[model samples]
Target: MIDKLAWIRIENGAILTARSHNRDTYYIPGGKREPGESDHEALLREIKEELSVDLILETVHLVGQFEAQAHGKPAGTLVRMRCYAADYHGQLAPAAEIEEMVWLTYADRAKVSAVAQLIFDSIHQAGLLK
Candidate 1:
């Protein structure tokens, strides 16, 4: 299983997502934790690296944990995604391996990873997403 972290940035009823270089589907902006890194530390680092923005540490909160068969991976491979909600400073921009950044609504569900689709469903059910 691949463990990953993600930042759930909601604005104007949409969630921020990223599409990596040469990737077709988008993902919530975050990445796997480095060796010996805590979730917050990893999340902050990944977000800054991928989105070119500094996450407000004090504003970070766990949104949920989700698991699904890893997208585009071989059968039996799984991905466990730990998602968080946070406020950030600086303008959002695509960086590093990220090719594009987008704000997606419920209608854009099919454009994201499977676990991300679950995250969208949960947020929509909570009436937090459009």
Candidate 2:
């Protein structure tokens, strides 16, 4: 199983997502935790690396944890995603391996990764996303 962390940033009723270079599907920003790193530390570092923004640690909160079949992996591989909601400083922009940054809504579900689709469902249901 692959374990990952994601930053859930919602603005104007849309969620922040990113598409890596040469990739077709968009995914929530954040990445795997490094050895000895806590969730918040990893998330902060990953987001800054991917999005070029500093996450406001004081505003961080757990959104949810989701598990699903890992996308594009061999059968039997699973991914456990721990998601968090947090405020950030600085403008959002694509960086590192990211080629594009997008704000996605429910209508754009088909353009995201499976795990992101599930995150959208939960956020939409809670009226946190439109």
Best model per lDDT: 1
Q: Clash totals for all models, in order?
A: 0, 0
Q: Mind giving the per-residue lDDT tens digits that candidate 1 earns over 1-130?
A: 9999999999999999999999999999999999999999999999999999999999999999999888899988999999999999998899999999999999999999899999999999999899
CA lDDT of 38 in candidate 1?
Answer: 98
Best by TM-score: 1
- Residue lDDT tens for model 2, 12-125: 999999999999999999999999999999999999999999999999999999888788898889888999999989988889999999999999998987788889999999
Clashing pairs in model 1, backbone N/Cα/C closer than 3 A: none
TM-score on alpha carbons, each prediction = 0.98, 0.97
